[model samples]
Target: MSLLNDPCATPAELADRCEEAGLDLAAAPTSSDLEAVGAFMAQWRRVVACSEHEPRAATLNALMLEYASAPWLTDHAGTGWHLHFREPDVDVPRQIAALISVGTALHLSGLGMDRLGICAAGECSKAYADISRNGRQRYCSTTCANREAVRRHRATRASATV
Candidate 1:
């Protein structure tokens, strides 16, 4: 849920996020690689910005068009066979893009287009892809939800005292 907003994101931070996503990391990402990913994530923000289904789909479709190839199968490095939407020989940034673009498409299609949303808590502005069963997520996490709740309760008490 971190935003690189800058193409000059530090190598370690980029590596950590990639690692958390299960990407194989024999070495740290280079400057250009970080820049490429930063740019891609910028595009990703556009998808998150769209609150409605169609606009989100259109933005994601544009990303898939740019980054993904026709579906293909792979079992590279002894992993179990799985489908991929990217050419086998693409560079790291392109590969990452393909993985994310297709993954996002499936998630939105299977879950709900309204699943991707920003935190409703004041000034938090964090993005979250809601995977909860109920799908009523409004805040990014319990902390934000609690914070907003406290604010509401205090406001109610203050009004009662007036």
Candidate 2:
């Protein structure tokens, strides 16, 4: 969701994001690749922002249909085999889209559809995928939580004085 949250407008920035995400890219991403990935992020943000599980599932299913290829097992390196849900020899952007779509599907199903959310802080628009054991996470981070808490406290104090 970082791509959707704070988008990389340039190819270099997109490369940095892929690096931060630890993606093994066969080649440097291009502007066209960045555009494709940005579009994919937009669709994913829709899935995350949906409050209902049924709609979220339908959106995810559509994304998987559009982006994901048939699943295949591979051990590209000498490591143990693992399943890849995308076609081989695609560009980095397509690969990342497949990964995100599949990962989101797994996350929502394994956890709960409500586990995906946008931060509740009024000023923050960041999206988060909740993996907490209790699955009661609301804020994207502790900073947002603290900020909201302080806002509530100050509001309570101001009301009491009135």
Candidate with best lDDT: 2
Error of 1 at 16 (Å): 3.7
Tens digits of per-residue lDDT, candidate 1, 50-104, equal 8988889999999999999999887885768888798777876887788878888
**Pairs with backbone N, CA or C atoms under 3 Å apart (clashes), candidate 2:** none
When summed lDDT is taken over every stretch of 10 residues in candidate 1, the lowest stretch is 1-10
TM-score of each: 0.89, 0.93
lDDT of 2 at 22: 69
On residues 75-96, what C-alpha lDDT tens digit does candidate 2 reach at each position?
8864678988888878988888
Deviation from native of the Cα of residue 20 in model 1, angstroms: 3.2
**Per-candidate clashes, comma-separated:** 0, 0
